[model samples]
Target: MAFPRNGLTSAAPADTRLKLKIARKWTSAEGIVAIDLTASDGAPLPAFTAGSHIDLFLPGGFTRQYSLRNDPRERHRYAIGVLREPGGRGGSAYVHDRLNVGDLIDTSRPRNAFELDETAPFSLLLAGGIGVTPILAMAYRLSSLGRDFEFHYCARSADRLAFRDEIEASAFAGKVRFHLDDGPEVQRLSLDRLLAYRPAGAHLYACGPSGFLDAVVSRAKPGWPADAVHREYFANAAPKAQSDQPFRITLASTGRSFDVASGRSIVEVLADNGIDIPVSCEQGICGTCVTRVVSGEPDHRDLVLTDRQRADHMTLCCSRALSAELILDL
Candidate 1:
């Protein structure tokens, strides 16, 4: 490899942490609310790309991932819109009810699991319900770049839709399309019709409830490339306990050991024994609770680790020990 003429230079490391406070809150729709945040200490914020997300550390040791709905160019603050699913899991429920206006929180610096693929000649964005969060950023970027991109925002009704007026008022007014289930049949988003309109060199990004994403996958599978289809699942069932069998954890660095109950997570067991592990996402989707595994096999249960990462290391927040006895780094 050749070095630059201005002497050896390395790329700047990405910022991976943010200390922020809830700056403002507004109800976007019937069940959705938007939360804006800013640095509590007036420090410079990190830059992020479209389709990025931040790991929010909520109270009661709960961590969840939310996409950055606001534009990434504005660095003074960040914003995210969350839907309160009453019948769903507890994360959104707590954020809607318990999170106050001035609460301080720790967030992982923006990470992009879904990125805009600019190489394509054009793009098609399909958002089901709150899945619009990530794709909205893509729409903003595409509009700014003068690219040919279209968006289909689908929801049950107009009142349930998020950012309806703002999106319609933007420059993307002509490019954006709304599909309501209660509207006329021709106005609803049709998988068959969308499939027929698929253009060459167009990437399709979809996110939403499990059923919606499943339909997209079922309809677009045989024709779409693996990289062309991007999806995120919002309807994940809470992870269950391993079994009734108990296990022992030995701290390799400190030569200390502890017993972990079958129903308890490694984080819970360690916290009970005075071990503090900094974590944000407890569902295993965020790599915040990653710890070195000294010995013994790990029973991986989290979605954060890739197949290759699971083969190498493990997440301690949700992943538990599969072996009867295991060794861990402090």
Candidate 2:
């Protein structure tokens, strides 16, 4: 029920699940649905920054996260764009099929893992597909600050690009460039073209599909400074992790215990046992799965917690206990 210290909030306890009523739904291109929403009760909600995402608890026990695409300063409502991924595990299907205007849905409060660094001299943004959601916010902020920046957005085509007009109308539009897969190869962004502008003080941020991210990362390695490159993958990274090893989790509050099999995560195990713990992006970026360690060390595999946070609290969703037994603040 408590909010995250890093300015993230969840639905109120009594309202553990807030109803998201669609105020408007429009297709950005051919298939992508840009959903704008307001709480059904029409009450004020917690504010969020760019790169913040919310957990939508859908039917069939599915929880999918979508980044906030609208200006973060607007506290009255939330907006997100969902691409109908037929290959996806039904998350996008429900968004495009069952959801509609006036439909009430359960959703989590805003939580952010991808955030912009205000101190950076300039920003170079790369967006692919729906990955543009968070970068869109950074563009807004950087524009307001009058920071020098450039946005290279690549999508299959113009129709698939979300908020094309708005992004162009933004104060940062002069620096914005669009690349369509259907266009000639020279028009698309390549390491060769982007690296030319990678000045000494510029910071590069990229987000998109794994293939696109990999391409960007490979291209950036040559000339970009180590600290200047930052990337966010909307999907989980490759699981180089070994097979699961069963472990024991001891809860300090009630002295309860549970067994976390190698096949499942601690968060999933706890949730199955009716334990109430807040979590989003169960893959690890959201930091919603953070819990204090009572005893023993953690394996610390999640991306949410920093080196300092891992020395203090650990993220239980993707991280596991490294020691024989571990105690946590359940």
Tens digits of per-residue lDDT, candidate 1, 70-170, equal 76677877788888867645778887888888888877777765678877788888888888888888888888888898899889988878988889888
Per-residue CA lDDT of candidate 2, range 137-218, in tens?
8888787777888899988877778889889888778899998878454356666777765775888888788788778877
* Per-model TM against the reference: 0.70, 0.81
RMSD of 2: 5.0
lDDT of 2: 0.75
Candidates' C-alpha lDDT:
0.73, 0.75
Against the true structure, whose lDDT is highest?
2
Index of the highest-TM-score prediction? 2
